[model samples]
Target: MGIGQSGSKFAISDLGFVSGGSKRRDLGLNQLILAEIGPIKGDIRRPVSCALIRLLQDPDVAVRLASCRSLCFLIGDCNVSEEDFNEFLPTCWSACFRLMEELQEFDSKVQILNLISVSMEHAGEKIVPFAKHLTDFFQKMWEESTGESLLQIQLLAALRNFVGSLGYQSPICYDMVLPILQKGIDINNPDELNLLEDSVLLWEATLAHAPSLVPQLLDFFPYLVAIMERSFDHLQVAISIIEDYIIFAGAEFLNRHASSLAKLLDGIIGNVSDKGLLSTLPIIDVLVQVLKF
Candidate 1:
């Protein structure tokens, strides 16, 4: 029996499977800890956590995933300190990045990403203190995993949540995002066929939650014109983006992109279906009202 400061008992025999166990046993132990050892006080909990963290590098992919899920719950509910949790982040981050590289199953990879998200949710604003580390990890993950569309999409969605959580501190990572955002929005790119839609959504997410539009972001306005020209596949999303630009960048946006914007609006009005027109017209009114045209 493993004993803790509060006289809590964790059966050591159960955790012995952690060192030489089948995937199923490892999975069982993880759930066992959360159910049984959740209130385990004192240093007794650390060895169980270490077992799970080491299992993160296990040969069995199932074990790795189960181990990660357990760690998230342990630090979230077990008597773990924020300082220890912060120290644990590097191990967790590296394990996740390695798993992302190794795991072929789509669902497994998503579980890994969502596990990070769950950690963020449990930690709440406490995560803000590690923005630099989090963004560094995000940049590396993106750089190391190019051309993997599903991974790219999942990571962007996760990163968008991070941006929203980071709130005012989000733009610290904009330098990493700018190129991806630019590449995703370029309708001419062959890969954009898969990435464009999510990329547009990410753009809107960034714009909506961002504290202020940096100059590079304002420059993204013309890409919306490009998107409008190709197709109104993202009509309402595109319209909403334009409204944000007009509201935020004001006269400078109009002066910089007026002619092309006018031409794009003219084509949109001429070509958009009645349904699409319903969405496009008000933004046009806003544009005219803003410019006093």
Candidate 2:
């Protein structure tokens, strides 16, 4: 067995086709850990995909969750050839459909969170419609203040990220995300504040990846600005997201939403110290560029 960098817990040899081999069955936690550390090299795309597909079907929840997480990460790293991914897509989508159906039955918010995360991260455009349903479920769950459900919050963020990343490539998804966002912004429960905060962060993250969403931004920002004005604790995060919006979405984004964007910036700048204002100089330069153009 090939030893991994840290030690002998797992090795390159462990990732091969025969997952039930002595090492995989004996020492490994699950197919996830095995697929992660195994030495399944470049040409083994189909085999690796098949192995992950099987692992994704494992009866154990933890095993299946781990497999989903690993598969998402692996797809990013493998430099998966297009033809190979085309072959891989059907199987990947099938698992997503199955897992999404399963997630509907999940009582554990954390498991559901991880499921949403990996599904969004790996399933890409294929999972957008389901993500809409999942986000709606989260919206209802957000109302019941069952303590701070961090996983649910983060998964909502991830779902937003996935929708942003996929963009108009999935227009049906576009129609779905905004309504969920509207619901969170309108509802007021002190305990649900963090959920709202996460919702705003999700919106900002979406803006970062999908600049095209800029045109529709005014629909959301006014409510966020009002919330920031009233809340001392969440003000900084709100301002940070606006700054990120300025940077990533660029001047064109600001130009399209100019009047409203400026109003929001004024609100944010008004809350900051002089040092914060000074730090905004570069953003000013960008604004200047947009004006010149």
Candidate 3:
């Protein structure tokens, strides 16, 4: 259809022109042009979406990636309401998944990961219907990707948005995440630096947003002591995690980990600078109040 269709005033012919082009470069650039314009027109989203689905699976990586980016732009900019966008979501998700399964490059996976994260974010409550499927997808991806740390990092970033959007429903993804989270937060591992920051943030996000602690999450709590013992850098998140554990895990957690917790606090008390000491006090006070030590 022409840009003049449906009484639309904007001339997007130059932008939409390449949608018909046969070349990879034309296909790739066309997808970007569509992304730059958000939705072409409210009347045409279905046909535009249909074209994007085909382009998203194009042989050229650039074309596929650009199609994913266009979807991201449309979802993020709110040009289409959630209810309206929901119509194309199934095909959009399928095309994205096929690309994810077919693509071998870590960078390409990064783009798709961003695409999923953006979709989950913008789809809002609409995504709840897919919660189980999404949880399963990430679990399977984590298992298959194995040693691909770069992809794992992006996956972790994506999971934060996933969990944040899911709120109380978030812990369902924990079975897949906790093991990875354990490895990511390990101070002993030299390779963890890249994963550490995001892992910690994911951990905090899980603790903050997850409706109830899964068994693995409770088991994951003690790792915080080791983290504090290793460096002061994560102390703020560490403190927040502690408060969460106290609130959620309660006295049972304190009673179980008290000795190591006490030892860790002793070290933090003597070594940290005054400003750091001030920051540390509240956590220590809270601990002391609860444990009476």
Off by over 4 Å in 2: 1-39, 58-66, 69-86, 103-151, 168-171, 186-191, 209-216, 231-267, 282-293
After TM-score superposition, what is the CA distance of residue 121 in candidate 1 from its true location, in Å?
A: 5.4
* lDDT, model 2: 0.57
Kindly list the per-residue Cα lDDT of model 2 for residues 1-293, writing each as its tens digit: 22244465644456555666443542253444445555435656655566666766666656566666656555665555555554555555555546655554444445435544554555556554455554555555554424545655665676575666465553445455665566556436543565787776666556555545444554566676567556645655565556655655565557655676677668658877786666556657766765675
Question: Each candidate's lDDT (Cα)?
Answer: 0.75, 0.57, 0.73
Better of 2 and 3 by TM-score: 3
- Mind giving the per-residue lDDT tens digits that candidate 1 earns over 160-263? 67776766767877878778888888888777888888899989878876777798898888788888888878988888887787777778888887887788
Give the Å error, residue 85, model 2: 5.1
Q: Pairing residues by index, what is the TM-score of model 1?
A: 0.71
TM-score of each: 0.71, 0.62, 0.80
Best by lDDT: 1
Summarize candidate 3's per-residue lDDT along 169-240 as a digit string, tens digits.
776666776777888888776658777888999999888987766677878766777787778888788878
Counted clashes in each candidate structure: 0, 1, 0
Ranking by lDDT: 1, 3, 2
